[model samples]
Target: MRVVVDGMGGDNSPQAIVEGCVLAQKEYGVEIIITGPKEKIEAELAKHEYNKNAITIVDAREVISTNEAPVKALKTKKDSSLVKALDLVKNGEADAVVSAGSTGAFLAGCTLIVKRIKGISRPALAPVMPGKNGPFMIIDAGANADCKPQYLTQFAQMGKVYFENVLGVNNPTVGLVNIGEEEEKGNDLTKAAYQLLKEEDINFIGNIEPRDIPKGKVNVLVCDGFVGNTVLKMYEGVAETILSEIKTEIMGSFVTKIGGVLLTPVFKRFKKHYDYKEYGGAAFLGVNGICIKAHGSSDARALKNAIKVSKVYYDTGVLEKMKSAFAEEKDTLKIDE
Candidate 1:
């Protein structure tokens, strides 16, 4: 698989991003295409020994900052690393795009440059989050801030495909994020979406309350971007705060410190389940091309893992499946894309 890396994006741009491309090129053997200022990318590449044939460089002088408006950035920063990397996918120069740049800019570029699936209403930001039992997905995580009932229903379908192909889940159970498990709960939006979800040919598990998310109640959790974003941030925050508190209590004194030493291995194993680096990045589903949004502060390890995700996406042919899924329904389904 040929994957493009935005070498100028992320907090550790060019350095961590470039190092990550080398690691993935060596381990996964995916052709690495790095986009950024050529000299800067070259300097970073010099730090590591790699097969020159496996790695390619594309020079992009402009950069879009995290604070810039997403749409405007994509338009103005035409030659940005983010834009150049995405262009490679659009032009079939690469199979997938992996970037840790501005989320807003990245999403905008994917939707505009790479384009959405033929009939897809909106592409969802689906990330495989480490759950209590195992990893699960929350679709439309932050892609579309506002959505209709039908949009949420489509999210479930796309998410189901991902669970089966990528996560190896068969007939994955799905649920709508709501205030109550009962169908007659939540605002008008959830209530309407609940009914639409039932009509789709999926393993719909009814409404799933926010409290049930961390427990891994369902494999594919569906919600609009606003709610999904809140759930994701809250889950991450609570887990991090709890781990921090545990560390503080573990170091109360010499007696507790000895106990902490004994439990260090256990803690490491437990923490691994919640580490964001393990998952790498979130896939922007429904796009015509493969676009992954790596964490803004991704390290070399995280970057390598993100490339692994791109490989899984390519190897599994998940994008092709998604295309076929909506392609057949275009005639019967009145999708107003």
Candidate 2:
């Protein structure tokens, strides 16, 4: 399978992205098509010794800036690396596309160029996070700011198929993010979503409170982008703050320093749990083509992991399963305005 990478989008640009492509090709034995300026990509490749045959470059003269408006950029910068990479997916030249560029640009590029899956109202971004049980899949992670109960219920259905096929979790339990575990705890949105999930064929495990998130209450957490983004940002902030505090305290005193050294391995283990890069990349689900969004600050290893994640998506036949899953639940999804 061919995995396309936007080589000129991130802070490190062609260098880190090229390094990632080489590594992923070596490790996963998959073909990589890098999209960027031919000379720049060639220069980056010259710096490293790799199997040159495993990598190919697709010349994309333009580079879409992060500050540019996503929808407008997609139209104006048709030859941009991000746009070209998505085009590869659209033309069937690649199995999937990976980008570390502007989130909005990637979203718009995928929507406009690669298109959305049939029967899908909107394409949602779903990222897997380390949970108590294992990896937990959270959907609409800032893809759609506003959502209806049916949208959330659809996320549950799609998320279930994703975790089962990609993450190897069978019959994954679904939870609606709410103020409390009680059915009547949340606002009209969550309440309505809760009722809809209960009526579906999914394994609805009641509601999941914010407190239960880190403790791994459920395998799938479904929420609107507003709430989902809030939870994601909060979790990131808290994880960073706690790690910083631990580092400061460890170096503040000699006694604490000794304890820190003793607990170094344990701390490393804990840090891995909070490491977003460890999960590889976030998949923009419900799209016609396989598109992955890597963290902007991602290093070569993270980029490589993102490529691997795309292959997993391709192999799992996620799109096919989604079509069947949604078809089976078609009758249950009809709602009154």
Candidate 3:
């Protein structure tokens, strides 16, 4: 499989991105096309020893910043690394596109340039997070801050297909994030969404309280972007804080220091569970082509893993499966509307 990467889009820029692409090419045996200013990209690439035939470069003169307006940047910056990389997927020159760039720009570019699958109202951002059971995914993890009831239903359906196909979960349990497990809990949106989710042909598991998320009670957690984003950030913050506190205590004294050394492996394993790099990036579900939104601060390892994740998405044929499912549900969807 071939993946088009934005080599100039992240905080680490060409260096981290290039190294990551090289690692992915070497380890995964996938062809990579890195898009950016030719000189900058090549400079970092030359530092590493990799299979020359497996890596290619495409020149893009512009770079989009996080502060720039997403829609405007995408429309005006035709030669930008972000836009050019996306074009590769739109034109079928690549199976997937990976970017550690502006999240807003990535979402806009995919929705406008690559487009969304038929019958999908809005594409959702679904990212897998470490759960006690393994890993669970949160759909609309900051895609649409505001959504209709139907949108949540769609997120549930899309999240279900993704978890099942990509993560190998069978009939993944779907849950609506709310204040309580009761059917009548939540604002008008969640309450309305609860009813819709119940009617859909899915493994609806009812509501999921935010407190229960870490327990991995459900495989797919569906909510509007606002709530999902809040949950994701809070979870990350809590995990980081806990780890930090643990490290501080472990090094406080000679005895503790010895204990730290003895338990280093255990701590490493625990940290790995919450590390964002482990999962690579979040998928922009419902997009016509594969588009993965890597973390903006992604390092070389994270970028490599993101590419691997993209390959799995491509190989699983999740896009085609979503298209078929949505197409078949189009008629029934209208009735429910």
Ten-residue stretch with the least lDDT total in model 1: 328-337
**Which runs in model 2 stand beyond 4 Å of their true positions?**
335-337
Better of 1 and 3 by lDDT: 3
Tens-digit lDDT track of model 2 for 172-225: 999888998788889999988888889988889999888888876588899998
**Per-prediction TM-score:** 0.98, 0.96, 0.98
Clash pairs for candidate 2: none
Candidate scoring better on lDDT of 1 and 2: 1
Go through the candidates in order and give the C-alpha RMSD of each one to the true structure.
1.0, 1.6, 1.3
Flag clash pairs in model 1: none
Pick by lDDT: 2 or 3, better one? 3
Give the per-residue lDDT digits (tens) of candidate 1, residues 75-192.
8888999999999999999999999999999998999999999878888999989888878899988998898888988899899998899989999999899999899999989999
| Model 3 misplaced regions, further than 4 Å | 334-337
Worst 10 residues of 3 by lDDT: 328-337
lDDT for position 195 in model 2: 82
- Candidates in order have lDDT scores of 0.91, 0.87, 0.93
